[model samples]
Target chain A: MPTLEDDDLVFRFPQNCGRSTFRIAFQRTLRIPDSDREYPLPPGLGTFPLRHAEDFPALPDRMAARGGVVMPMWQAEALWINCSHAGRDDLPVAVKIAAGKINAVTGEAWRPGLHRDPQDYVVAPDQPWLDGFASAPGQIRQFVAMPLGDGYTAEEQITGQAEWGGLQISVTPMKRAAWDRLRKAWWPGLGERVAYLHDNFDRMSMGLGAGGLMRQRIEEDPHDLADWDQRATERVFVSLVHAAQWSALTGQQPPTAPPSAQAYAKAGLPWFQHYGCDRPALPGASPLRDLFSVAELHKAQTGQVLPGSQDIAAELPVRPFGTRPREVRSPGGW
Target chain B: MQRSAAPSFGTHVRALREARAVEDSRFSLRQVAARCGVTPAYLSRLERDESPPPGAEVLVKLAHELQEDPDVMLAMGGKISDDLRAAILARPRLFADLIRALRDTPEHAVLRILREVRDGDW
Candidate 1:
């Protein structure tokens, strides 16, 4: 089971699994223009607040059935999944993130089991954060929210149905033997990792859809399929209610919308791009590729322009950091 | 139900150790005690709050075995880390004034101070 410690959803594995834990946070970020221009990663404004679905009275039936946690988001708001681990940052935890039952990485229908050939899941610590759908090699379209049943959602667009309107995440950790081998081979005397910070919505149920593409890479799975503990997987379904609905249901005001791409650029805030190792990125998912941006879909369906669909400014300054070495393939410092 | 009283340092330690042991046999109290070079009986007493917090050196060992930050373990045990103490002593008046001045400040304010110092964002 995943627990909401502060604002982070923490999934802790059983003791036999070395007490491996993964922390996931929903980060508020700029909703880049849904135009043809791909943009650099926007700064994380803050985390969205989360509450236990069970804590509130009279939850929507689907949300009650899911029974994990609920968070509110403004329609068209963009978010990124921040991934980290307690105890060890390098802990190998495989995470499969799906929005409305559509696989965020593979752009395939949701499946209970992990996959490798196309690498349907991302490994935490190595991958760090996921900004959006895996659109192209080393590139992703950002995760933007839209109301369900609106053709804007990946669920409705791909599945021809909008049955699920929230996010589903399942995590699997590395097998003990594989983890021990890596730990011993790597930094044997490594110090404890500083824990990641936990930091926080609306009333309508929303689903994630592809937005502007960004320069982000979902790292190739560095470990073999056998290295993952498939039998011991934990899954959680996150219900994203509309921010206005958030105030109505939870009696708390939802967070204000994030700054526009123009406002962010005007402030000259630093945009980030992590420099990673030479591990090749997975080829873009076919189904996720060629999907219409929310604005384009809205325009096509309604013959009306989507609000906030203006083109993003070009030449947003990019600050490169984190020269990450490939930890898996590196030989022993022991 | 809300806990009536905050757990004592020993109760906290015992609970943390036992919980980890229950999930993983490698963390069984005796195993942890052995790893930390303490007797199982003494460790049990420590958990029961019958004994005072262990010395800093012993607490460090326990912290490492328990996968907890040594500084946190020291603080929970009502002790200051030796290095932190030395640092404080290095600038006795400055740190003394700083701690006293910030005594009643809110946590967020303290965090802001820390961020400013760490980032040199003056």
Candidate 2:
């Protein structure tokens, strides 16, 4: 139950690309037990956990990796202030405030000064605690601090990083519809890739996906999962997505490639070649040997010969299973 | 079942001083500390809740400097009644450990424990 001090007001703004800039403006004032000296902040300045800070740094990377940036606006741009009484059984309520610029075109700043009128509102502690403080009336609203980090899933990671004093704020102007479309298109495929790795956990001994090792260990021993019971499996999946997306955005090479033929051979799995006319003798052919040959895999998977050549479809398998499947109509057509 | 109010005599004195725009009125911590006969660091700590309550004499002196009533300062600290204690206790973190334990428990088990605790009707 720490009290507010005058010096606690900290303002942070981005120094890089205009696309990444976000300003955090707040003032900390002491609340006397029964004083007439009341100061109510405007609705624009009241939003808790402002969105600009959380969305900026990761924007450039997201733009490059995911075609267009996906910024969660309404959910990400709120501001919050933490206030709790000392030695109280009740939890601290983080007051959420709504903030918006008077005019984005004018570029004006909000300077702290006396206001003749201010909006008054009361905020409950936790979402559930809202019931207890139903009758309480005050200009200040309360909010609960949201815990966030690596352990949280992508959806759960929406919470701010409180300890760093870094508010999870996003300043991007990307509309919700655009962001939703991008995420919808991107996530399903990403989930499939991650699921593939998880299913073939034993075969995946190396690579960025290998970090799933911890997850594999948890799945191996149910006790491990129970140790961190509050966490859900979706949280783990989110962490993997964050890790993979982060790597992709940063352009850092994945530590290892998907399991190679050698890795499969080591695991005592048969190595078979499905395509390519220049098939080497089968006696020593190992899947690990062909795993690194991306050029051949592409040719094999597509059933399309090299660009400059005139190889006909007759040369390849009549109906290659790996090639794109024929579009089928729904069984229950209108 | 009401508990006695805890003393917040210190916060009262500071708040009154702030309201009067006493000292430099520049909103600088250093100016306020100098006017209050204390070091800047100590004043900063007092404002941030790092130190315990300041003395009555100091409170009186701060009230005088701010041109506010000493009694007003004392009342603001909740020294006049025990209601303050109940209010403070009701604030968040009063049962932080218990809340955290409940939150950390397995979701299924937590429901059962909550049911038992509620059924016990404490």
Candidate 3:
């Protein structure tokens, strides 16, 4: 079950699975200009406040039954998923993240079980954060929020339907035996004491639509597929409620509006460039390749224009942040 | 999950170092050890808990280099800095009582007390 810990959703595994936990947070960030020019990664503003759907009145029964959480987003705000492990040496958990039932990596429809040929899910602790849909190699169209039923979401663009309008995440952890064997082989020097350290949706609100392209590579899984415990998967639905509806349903104020990409650039805040593992990157998904950006969709739907549609030319310095690549220590000698 | 016991001083130092290193490559083991005037081999042993935690000078240097509060680094090393030790020794009973009274309180409450002490009218 996933518990809200310090604003991050902490999914704890069963005792049989060594009780390792995965933490994920929905971070609010700048909505890059939806233009042909790919932009640098934006800075994280803060986490979007989340609430259990059951705590409020007038929630859809489907959401409650699926064990869903709710968070408010403005019509055009953007978000990114932040993934981490509770402790340093815990086993990596495979996470399948789909926005509105469309796989963010492969752009396939939501389905049970992990996929290896295309590698649909991300491995936590290895791939720390997912900013947006994998559009191409080392490039992702940023996730920008748009109201459902208007035909801007990846779900609507790909599926030709919008039945599910929220994010779905299911996690599968490594089997305990595999972890023990790997630990014994991988870290022979470290003593035993070190080992201990390890929806719904409703749609009524918004779903993720691809925005501008950013430089990000969704890494291919390094561990063998056999290591994952396929049977012990836990899934949750995240419903994105619009600010007004959220206030009406929960009777609380929604978060302030996010700053525009242009404004943020003008303010001289450092954009981020995450230096991740050197693993091979997955080829981008085809279904999501040609989806219209929010700006493009808005321009096509309504004759009126949105400001800052053209890519910002400002030279926003990119701040490099990443794990220093260490020597790859393999569990030698099978 | 509850931890079996509090982490050792070496474990805490390694965790802090690694956390910083993960955020920025400038804090890599060799880089931090070099910046803090220590050998990487010795630092690695200290991090892996094979060696005892270092004294206040190294801890203070590491705290400064890692952008952590010096007091926190000293406490994590299971040592009170000389100045703090002198202050405690000057009023041992009162300080002990104050520490005991505040130990069980939440961090926010302690922070509130700190703010009051800083902004209070003497």
Candidate number with greatest lDDT:
1
Whole-structure CA lDDT of model 1: 0.77
lDDT of 3 by residue, A5-108 (tens): 44677676654344456778888887888877877777677778877766766876655554567788888788889886653456778999999899999999
Residue A15 local lDDT, model 2: 19
Rank candidates, TM-score, best first: 3, 1, 2
The candidate that wins on TM-score is: 3
Per-residue lDDT over B20-102 for candidate 3, one digit per residue giving the tens place of the 0 to 100 score: 77666888889999989999998999888898788889999988777566788888887888878998999999999999999
Residue A256, model 1, lDDT = 82
lDDT tens per residue, model 2, A223-269: 11112211110000000112234343334332211222122223442
Give model 3's docking category: incorrect
Q: What is the lDDT of residue A265 in candidate 2?
A: 27
Evaluate residue A77 in candidate 1 and report its C-alpha lDDT on the 0 to 100 scale.
Answer: 94
Of candidates 3 and 2, the better by DockQ? 3
Name the runs in model 3 displaced over 4 angstroms: A14-19, A188-203, A324-334, B1-122
Q: Could you report the DockQ of all the candidates, in the order they appear?
A: 0.03, 0.01, 0.05
Model 3 residue A54 CA deviation (Å) reads 1.1
Question: Candidate 1 chain A: worst 10 consecutive residues by lDDT?
Answer: A325-334
